[model samples]
Target chain A: MRRFATLALALLALGAGPRSGFETMTPELQAMQRDDFANPGMLWVAEGEALFQRQGCTGCHTPAQMVGVAARYPVFDAGRDGPIDLAGRIAQCREQRQGAAPLPTESPEALALAAYVANQSRGLPLAPDPDPRLDPARRQGEALFRERRGQLNLSCAQCHDDNAGRRLAGSAIPEGHANGYPLYRLEWQGLGSLRRRLRSCMVGVRSEPFPPDAPEYLALEAYLAMRARGLVVETPAIRP
Target chain B: MRAACAALLLWAAPVLAQPAAFQVVGDTIPASLTGTPGDAARGRAIVTTRQRGLCLLCHSGPFPEEPFQGDLAPSLAGAGARLTKGQLRLRLVDGRRLNPATLMPAYYSTEGLVRVGRAWQGRTVLSAEEIEDVVAFLVTLQE
Candidate 1:
């Protein structure tokens, strides 16, 4: 742990250089993350693949076309009135392109499909589009990351930026990057979305988490993706 | 009339606990919230526990048993020799008045906070008694 912290501190000293959560995991967990057959998140990826073929998604695009698409998400779309995250874009496709019923925020199908799409981009660095219109949303996301709003009065920056690589009780505090979406969390005992992780963090600080579908979450996601530029995507990543 | 009403209310609820109004005098609160000193043993319990106080989450202290103390704040070793009891009180109550961007939570305040969880609304993170207990334990950590 000390050696890991030294490396983490070294990275921080280099000015918030992006570090994958995989780099912070214990060797045992890291091995589990590496093994697709051993990782439980692969089960969801399998389900997502089945759903992709069954739902006629192959008509317009193949699974191969989705490679690196997750990295550029939460992009500004004038037709959508603002920025749309990867999941939002997927939901929009279901409605507008597929002419299917909207996927409920309460279901597992959305998460499954997201996992499948993001899995294709695994090992690729995050590179959100540098559109001028994304500036305001990204700035708002940055502010939210730094602003103290919870009962604990701690911001995301405080723990992640100032105190990253430190121990919080028995757990290691990673840099709070969103590079690992639909990751398998040991605490949750299942695969969960990036939004679920953010809401969990908000609740951990005793703050009122934004609603499940809040636009604020997209802004935060946009900011996190920007912050994690060059860090490899680790869909179905394992975390303790 | 308001004073008479206040007197009447106090008389009506003689056992009711009133909120202690702590005065900030130059980076310190020159009085205890409970009027008497807190039990150091009880204070120590709160500081080291995982749930209560959560001091070890960000502040490493002299508790050798707790190996994974945090590194966000300065070490708690010799805290008694460094800051006065009153000074510690103010920091626990609201350190933002001193350092606006401090990561330390205002354990004894609930004012002006945004989007506090429904279960924690209108409640301070720690009660006045808990604050005094923590301060009591902190003062015992001498060089």
Candidate 2:
């Protein structure tokens, strides 16, 4: 790890001329996910399962229905005028139907429930089933992805897709896949939702991160989940 | 009056064109360096205690004094000799300044400081003096 940091530092020194944005990884970040699951993040999933059972989520979204459910998230919801990710759907269920308070989007309770529910379909293929009926939501999500919002004037594609394998600052840009969601970020000290992850990125780019249950985030999650179609879901994965 | 206006413009221009609020010179270390032994004992306290650095939640160190720290960050057993004071300062300041995509938020950069949500807003998580102290403790880990 020390050697890796040295190599990265040397690279930074050589490239110290001019830069547009910050780097994302160093040896410190690389080691973040190596010892995952041992983190307190799993407790959220545990608690979420307890909450789910307590709330009788299986009564509506049964285990059989959920077998391939995680893979099909971020679908267009005609009701919301955007693709509603699983977290949004969960919050909706709690608020409207269950007569319960909405869970904080990035809070431990929300992350846990999302993990537990998403984990039920882990290893399932990502299969976003977008319908022509859902076109409006898809379009909204796509538009949001391309629109520059932050003070830094960056879009999601600027790093994730435009230069997928290229190194920015210090860390390499990933393929922009949502296959592993409900991920435990060592930086966050616990598990968080795909929505939370999206919100975090917004803040990173200096854009206004949406409110905990904001529709824009839900739409974005829908789009992201659709993009990961065919990839197997890996909930609660470790991220830097 | 004309000269006064020109001076005001000069100062205003520099302040206005100060580029981004944060400029990250990532890992810009001097070629020549010195070696020193760090007090792992003190580093342990800073990392483990929230009152001090509270770094244990996000990083793991080689502090034998404390048990049960997370490995979210690389071990700092030999960090003293590996990085310079300035380099460490950048990491402590806005670590994300080094990596735009970093999950590690700047411990110091208040650019995204949230007043409504944050218990401490409009302030860096740690002061420069505290960062220096933490760096000093890390630099002592060469032993």
Tell me candidate 1's TM-score on chain B.
0.84
Candidate that scores best on DockQ: 1
Model 1 spans with C-alpha error above 4 angstroms: A1-16, B1-19
Give me the runs in candidate 2 sitting further than 4 Å from their true place: A1-41, B1-143
Which digits, one per residue and each the tens of the lDDT, describe model 1 over residues A173-210? 78888987988888778888888878877877778999
The per-residue C-alpha lDDT of model 2 at residue B46 equals: 52
TM-score of chain B of each: 0.84, 0.64
Error of 1 at A59 (Å): 1.6
lDDT of 1 at A10: 82
Worst 10 residues of 2 chain A by lDDT: A16-25
Q: Any idea what lDDT model 2 has?
A: 0.57
